[model samples]
Target chain A: MSKFLLATLLLHIPLYIYPILRLCYWAESPLWLTLLIFIPLVSSQYMSRFYLRKKNSVWTKLLRRFADFYLGVSPVLLISTLLAEIFVGFHMVTFGTAVTSVIAITVILGIVATMAALSPMVKTITLSSGKLTAPVRFVQITDVHIGSRKPAFLDRVVHIVNELKPDFLCITGDLIDGQGVSEDDLKSFKSVVGPIYFTIGNHEKYEGVEAIARRLENLGVKVLRNAETHFTKELQVIGIDDMDDANQVAVQLEKQTLDKDAFVLLLYHRPRGLKAAADAGVDLMLSGHTHNGQIMPFNLVVNRVFDMIKGLYEHAETKLYVSQGTGTWGPIMRLGTRSEITLFEISPAQESLFPSR
Target chain B: MSWLDEGADVRSTSLTEEFTIDLYRETYQDRFIPLFVVESSGRLRVVTDKADIPADCKIISLIKSDNI
Candidate 1:
């Protein structure tokens, strides 16, 4: 067996098989009925893993969607079952009540979680910029995962961002994760008002970045590949490619001779290198990719992975804001987090005037 | 395969800590699922974990030294 399958199997013994055994015991099911449940339960993981990796047909896509939705619902089911089991253990509920309650709780919470994933809220962040004479407004939407998310979702994001009327849009990374997602699927990006600047995420690398970047460029996105551009006389925007290295922010910043007079705005995909950006005199950095754990206990895991998962973090002179992302990745549900489109309104700082003058 | 990617990939190794198992799809090379988003902060605050952060930030991780 592949390592992934093996690892998945080991994990599922505790996560899936144990839960099934408990449920079967609670209901006193026949061996055949137990087998029926086991087959589909065991197969869901492998089916999703194998089907959605490289290419996709209409059926594979449908299967992927089912698996994705199940992915979201499974967590809810597990948690509900866990809660019911706890109640039963405490003698507060009977096994039959526990089972029914688990189903009811899963259905309700599952729907709620799915709704949370479907809706993307507009989050406004205001900061004091050191270089700008006026407030610069821009919207940031990252990890949209256009593959799992349809283009209509992008259309909704664009419509919302356009309503905000920001100066420009910034996409940090993970814009596409599916090979099946085509350029036409991403046509709504052109409808977003103002310029859209992007850096490739890890998912982009997986989905053939060269092709994805080209598609984004065709749709009028400025794909910044370890590159920089002058947004205005007082603002310099630097885009760093999401390198598979620890000090991507530091290494990329070292290569750029930032304009002393302009506010240095850095767009990186992952949240790291804050001290590096600050040491290099970066004024502000924007990022996404953590998705703030994208779920409940998973957030706990993500917390272990990233130092700054969400919101603003300041280090010396640099400030970083990590977006919660604008779209869902899998299962199309958020247990403890909401999807967001971040709008940043940066006004000039009085302290910044001293250096510029 | 996910473990290999996480163990070997410099990015994954550096980005995450040990014992972090992924339950969701990664979709890199036909990987599994990724779901949920636990939002943080009470408004757009300057949340800090400066005390918990390690001092020496530049830790270069390679899965295997000989792999090209």
Candidate 2:
């Protein structure tokens, strides 16, 4: 097995086993019942990863749903059971009461988190640059993961974006997770009033970049593959394909002829290379791959991987805005983080060669 | 509107209608058509022959034309 797969199994197996064992011990479940619950939980984690490749198969679909549900509820189960054990050790509650309390809390919190994941919040920010000639409004939605999420979710997202009446729409990346994403899944994008631009993410590469790019282009989205398009006389939009290498952004920027006098907006999938963007004379960079870890505590780990986790940061002349993400990735659960669609209002800085009349 | 052959010498004659059409079709493709071609000398013209294209002039993309 590969190192990543091996590590995933090693880490997740224990996570799956511990909760069931503890829950069984507290509830005094029979050995057969314990075995029954344990087998599927452990196997599902591994099976889900592979079977998901057969996206449209009924068995794969069922397994994905089961695995997603298990993952969504597992964190709650594990944390609550741990707390229950601690409470029991402290003699604050009996074993039976502790297990019951944990179960109740997990169920309630799981439902709340699921609901939170369904509806995304919109975050609006305004930026001003001396190079801009006029105010521009745009909406950015990233990591919608349309294959994992149904078209209804995308419909709601599209509705919200159109309501904002943005000058244009940008999708940073990870728009779809599974292969064979149907036209129906992307049909709503055609209804969006403004032009839509997209840059590939790691997920798109996984699902097949050519397929996703073709589908998106057919839907009227301009897929920027290490290329650029002019938005206005004073503004230009550039995008590059996502790469694992840390210096990918810098390398890609070197190829472009950046206009120093115009406002240059970059759509990169990952939030890296702030210095390179600044050096390239890019005015703003929009990204959303981190998902801000998608769940709590995981965010801490994500923070270690990325220098900027969520929100906006300025480096020299370039500004970077990282969205938490518009949708969930693995499990449809969110804690201590929000799913967001970002709206940006950009205007020219108040300075002019000509005096006011 | 007239068209200059692809091989026509641009240095001597003004930009031909054919040259402009080919430039729009080839450079911008079917998606983007320049509404206003601005020359580097700060001179703006709706239509110009190849000879009129300033030596320092650069083609910048404007909004997508509905007709295209």
Candidate 3:
């Protein structure tokens, strides 16, 4: 067996088995009957992920959603099964009691995580810059993963952005993951009030960058490709294409004829470009790739992986803001982390009533 | 996984657009997804369909596992 399939079987088999065993104990049921019921439930994730997934196919959507949802709440189910097994094994509780308790815990935790995923919270950050003559408000939405998301979701996001009435909108990266949805679905942005700017994401490249960019540009989005444009005489907007290189920001910035006098706002997809942006004298940098891990323990893992996983960080004069993403990626669930849309209010020193305040 | 794709730099070319996943099943003897390397940018992807592989992408190595 390839290491991947073998590893998958080894991991999923145990994760699925315990939950079934717990349910069997709860009903005092035969193993065969429970297996019949739970096998399809637990196995759908693997079936859809490994075998096939077509975005437009009904069967594919159902199977993928089933699996993706399981992928999200499986952690809760597994942990509950473990605790239930321990409780019954130690004779701390009756099998029925242990099983019932586990079910309750899993259901509650699952709902909480699901709710967190569904709701996108607005995070506001204000910055004071002496260079700006007036206040500018911008809303950032990233990692919406449109194929995994429906058009309704985008409509709601656009509605919220319109309500916020930002001067402009910035989509850092990962706007569209798969090609299932087309320009018709993304037409929700037509209702939006201001100019939209975007940078290339890894997924956009994976699906095909030229096509995605062309579609966005046709919709009047400024698809910046290692390119820059002036938002104002004092503020410049630059978007460097998403790359796996550590020095991507530095290398791309080196090529740009930077207006050193302008307050530079650089947009790159990943959170790895702070030092380089700072060195290039960028005042602000925006990114969204980590998704704040999208789940509980994974957030801890994401922290170890990226020096700056989520939220804002300052390196020298440059301030970098890494969003938690406006949508879930794989599992469509969030635990301990909320889906986010960030709003930035860049104000001139003159506008501030109290400079320190 | 994008980060993991940083250094692999493999892109292969196929003569025809008719290249399908069955072609992969024929050679790799595996039922799982296959890799596509974009010839232009040298980007590697774990894609499902032949159509998912860009026109310029090349098929590189295929990894196989026992049927589960």
Off by over 4 Å in 2: A55-59, A352-357, B1-68
Q: What tens-digit string does per-residue lDDT give for candidate 3 at A90-116?
A: 899987787788778877887888888
* Docking verdict class for candidate 2: incorrect
In angstroms, how far off is A115's CA in candidate 2?
0.9
Interface RMSD to the true structure, each candidate: 13.2, 12.2, 18.5
lDDT: which is higher, 1 or 3?
3
> Taking chain A by itself, what TM-score does each prediction score?
0.93, 0.95, 0.92
List DockQ, one per candidate, in order: 0.02, 0.05, 0.02
State the lDDT of candidate 2 residue by residue for B1-68, as single tens digits: 21122111111111222224344334334444233444545566654343343433333333232211
RMSD of each: 14.3, 8.4, 12.7
Q: Proportion of native contacts in model 1?
A: 0.00
- TM-score ranking from best candidate downward: 2, 1, 3
How much is A67 displaced in model 3, in angstroms?
A: 0.8
Which pairs clash (backbone N, Cα, C closer than 3 Å) in model 2? B3-B18, B14-B49, B14-B50, B14-B51, B15-B49, B15-B50, B15-B51
lDDT of 3 at A160: 87
Ranking by lDDT: 2, 3, 1
